[model samples]
Target: MARAVELATVLGSDRVDQALGLAATAGRFADDDLVSILEHIAASKPVGEIVRADEAHSVQSGTIVWQALGQQPTAARESTGD
Candidate 1:
């Protein structure tokens, strides 16, 4: 759940939910695919670059408290063209 929220903070809730919902509905084969989807989302450059100061503060604070490690292998897979 914490990982999901960090992802959502970076990518936005709508996108996170959209991908997660797809994974949930796409049958058992989607488990590995789940990591792929998150990789795709994280790799995407933000379409809109606007940032409110408070939102930035919130993300940093949350990360410090949550202390979650990023799922880098998934990100690396997308970067390496898998």
Candidate 2:
């Protein structure tokens, strides 16, 4: 709860606080769900771009998002470093 509150504070947005409140109450969630949530929050790009045949753009966008989350890479940090 404290960690969620702290993260909500850092985010400094009512939307984030509300979402965190929900998550904290609901307890843990799956990694893919979390990633999907993050993608929504960051508005990285449309799902089409992510699933496009051009692997380079998809890889680049993924890299940008992974780095934003303090991760090395999805494959490297799939366990969430927990």
Estimate the TM-score of every prediction: 0.37, 0.28
Clash counts for all predictions: 0, 0
Local accuracy of candidate 1 as per-residue lDDT tens digits, 1-82: 5666776798788887867876778652344565677777678768687867785467454556354465455667788994
RMSD of 2: 19.1
Compared with the true structure, the alpha-carbon lDDT of candidate 2 equals 0.55
Candidate 2 regions off by >4 Å? 21-39, 44-82
How close to the true structure is residue 20 of candidate 1, measured as C-alpha lDDT?
Answer: 84
- Lowest-sum lDDT 10-residue window in model 2: 30-39
Most lDDT-accurate candidate = 1
Model 1 deviation from the true structure expressed as Cα RMSD, one decimal place: 21.1
In order, candidate lDDTs are 0.68, 0.55
